[model samples]
Target chain A: MKVAVVGAGSIGLLYAIRTQEAGHEVTLFVRREQQIELICNKGIQVEGESMMYDIHVKNIMDISGAFDLIIIATKQTHVKKIVELVKVNEIVAPLLFLQNGMGHIEDIHEIINPTAIGIIEHGARKLSDRTVAHTGVGVTRIAAVTMKQEDLIIYKQMLESSHFPYKLENDWFEVMSDKLIINAVINPLTSIFKVVNGEVVNNPNLFRIAKKLCEEACDALGKASVEYHLDRVKKVAMQTKDNHSSMLEDIKNGRRTEIEGISGYLLKRANDELPYTTFVYEGVQAMQQMDRREYE
Target chain B: MKVAVVGAGSIGLLYAIRTQEAGHEVTLFVRREQQIELICNKGIQVEGESMMYDIHVKNIMDISGAFDLIIIATKQTHVKKIVELVKVNEIVAPLLFLQNGMGHIEDIHEIINPTAIGIIEHGARKLSDRTVAHTGVGVTRIAAVTMKQEDLIIYKQMLESSHFPYKLENDWFEVMSDKLIINAVINPLTSIFKVVNGEVVNNPNLFRIAKKLCEEACDALGKASVEYHLDRVKKVAMQTKDNHSSMLEDIKNGRRTEIEGISGYLLKRANDELPYTTFVYEGVQAMQQMDRREYE
Candidate 1:
């Protein structure tokens, strides 16, 4: 299969290496000249629990052949642009978005036909530019859009044979909602408290606050069958004890965070009525202030 | 008149300078060897708005002369020990306390007799051991507990000629309550928000939250016939717009703050009944966490 990974972020590079290692030709779609130089010079290095390798890297404009699949691992804020660029450049393959938050896949589906799928797979960023330490050996759930069977089967086969576990679900909204609740709890609490993923376990008040936020997310989404979001948050936090949430990393790096995409999205969806979500929103704003002061 | 200033902190130093300028024999009581050395070597240099002067300084333990007036400007948390030291080692005069919040004067009164008067004055620090800067020229209000007519007349005359303004109040509770309201709004907000004093003016939400806390302080202390607490806060904040507030200075210097003496006092007095006070208590607690992270 011909796979093109967009954004060329750490997550994007990891996908490129894994897809290439699965006997597929992978091309990375990076925008910056410096990133293109670095990746093209060094190739894409994938460091996981058991293996490490580098794949041949390519820029989006330099690609020659059409891809059978385009996996977008960009941030939620950049999803619209990647979708537009791939559409304008005329690569009509099945695109799999594996980013945080919910409802963004609806935005993608509004632009294109029912070929895009949302994948919820756990991945960890181990370093700045070199590798993604794939810590969790979990199943990746890929849900096809509008009952697209052909795209679903091929993507599932590719993800499965790519040395990682994968699953296929016809109901994409369920997976998206579940992932959204998980993020609503974990991201904002860790970012606000400025703690590692594991510290929530020891701090009972903070853990209750995290659970309150998850309950708000669940109520806003109106999901009845979802598991308790706080339990999932604690389980995942225990699993990735040393990892800093990506939001916290953005704060430390003096970058604009995906708070707008995660907690801020829930705020917008609920029309700014949820108190817990608003608390998280205010906290992220404070984190932004702290970040600004750090660099200045 | 002979006066002794205990603690040698910024507030103590300012009071000592002004009292000495009023032609009273002033003796500053210091603790640290370095502080005693600097004061003895270079004298106590007080740089104010329109005046700079150096005066005599002395250690509390070596003091032999009797004083007609004693001013205690140590932190409120240590008021008991500070007063006990003064009582056990030296003669007790008409003591004046210029600390933050509401309890130190009463605590000292519990230890000694009701011979002490509480004063609320505006003063600030420039450095730890170098010079004390009187940022704002403000009157010191002293409420007498028990005083002779001759001593009151002389003390009033002394303060009047001192350069800094002076006022005498018959109601000690009112003056202390006014300062408590100022601290309720200024101290916790500046500490929690971790912003400069002027930032509260720009953020109305923060100002509103601060006003709620001021109301809580006013309600807890049933000293009647005063104007609204938040109005007093606005008046003081407007007066001291450029002042770096003692809480902000404590955070900058990594000192254990008087948050306990001010907000913590009101919060404990609230008896867990008022939700507004409880909210302010939690908010202040959260700010303490932020302060610890920033300082520690």
Candidate 2:
């Protein structure tokens, strides 16, 4: 199967390399010419505790070709731009979006192709332009946004391997919200405190704040009857203890964060009822702004 | 006039030296004998923009003998301990309590003698054990907490000078609350962001959070309707932009913050209705804990 992964970030690079390694024709769509040139010349490097390999794949600057599967592996903030690019280029394929929050779910409706959403439980970090550190491996859950089940089977079968596991779910909202709750609790707390995920639980005061944020998030999502548990959030934090959350990474790199999609989305849904959520959301936003200024 | 200033922190040293400079005999009551020895031998150095001078005021480890004016220039966290010392020592004098929050206001009730509360607007930094840098000079507002008008007049006359200006107010609660609202907004934000006070206003997102916090605080203090403006808070931040807030300084130095007296006090008074206040309060508490652990 031929696949094109948009955005050459950590997640995008990881998927692009892994999919190519699984005997599929993969092309990485990157923004910077330097990144494209670097990847094309040196290939992609994947380093981890158990695995270390490099895979050479075609890199592109234009979304001009049709593929069997199109993975939108950009941050949620860039999803809209990807959608616009795909629409203008008329690249019709089975679209799968791997983003961190629920805000991009609505944007999926704009895509006319069969669309699917994915949550990457694995932790991957970009070491350089063409290098990604596969920090941890976990099951990737994929669900249909507007895609037919029969259409997803081939893509799933093509992408899934013993090393790269994939699970399919019928309810994408639950998958996104479950991940949203976890991100909402861990991301901002770690970013605000400038600590690793583990510190949020190891530090008693931070643990309490995390618990309170989890409860507030759960209460806000209660109106939708979204299935969530504070324990599940804690469990995720514990599992990713040493990992810097994506939000924290964004702040460190002076990049815009997915806070608008995660906490900001929750704040919007909360509609003035979740005061704690509002406070955390605004506080993280302020920190992000400060981070950007420091880089400037 | 004979005055005894407790605590050898920046505020205590500033007041003690300034009072002595005004021709009044002042004694500094310090906890450690080292601080007393350092002050007694080196004297208290006041470094300012235009002038720098050292004044020798007797330092004592024990609180003995009656003082015409007793100024408690300790952090709010130490007020309870100071109150106990005063009670055990049975020193009956016109007591002036200089603290940052409203928590100590209730503790003032335990003192039987004439009591007054003060908010020091000046930005003073402790350069060393026997040295203080008067960063900025502002008016110190002194209000009678449980003191007679005539007694406050004499005490104010004794303490006021060209360098150390003092203003008298009828209500201490208003003065403390006014400062409380400012500290509640500025201190925690600066500490959390690890920025000087000016960043809280210069950064748009931080400024927004500051305004929101101020509004929430005003809402929480509904009955008294404390006279506070967000602009006043911003002005203070701008003026103290180069100086780390006392809370930030405390966090940086690995000392316990007066958060319990500022945001913690407001959180208690808010009665769980102020969710934003609770969130900010708990978030800062967690950061403080994290900071302490790093030093440990």
Winning model by DockQ: 2
lDDT of 2 by residue, A65-175 (tens): 768898899889988888887888888888999999888877889779899999988889888988888888888999988899887877888899999999988888877
**TM-score of chain A, all candidates:** 0.88, 0.91
- The CAPRI category of model 2 is medium
Question: Cα deviation in Å at residue A184, candidate 2?
Answer: 0.9
State the lDDT at A21 in candidate 2: 77
Worst 10 residues of 1 chain B by lDDT: B287-296
Task: At residue A177, give the lDDT of candidate 2.
Answer: 83
Question: iRMS for all predictions?
Answer: 5.4, 3.3
lDDT per residue as tens, model 1, B1-296? 77778777778777777787877787787778788888777776567345544656666666556777777877887787776776676565676777778767557565553353656566567555747877766677877655554565567767566467767777766787778877877876665555655545545655655655565677777645334666667777777666667776675566767877777677666644433344334444444454244212
Residue A104 in model 2: lDDT:
83
**Range of the 10 consecutive residues with the lowest summed lDDT in candidate 1 chain A:** A287-296
Clashing pairs in 2: none
Error of 1 at B285 (Å): 5.4
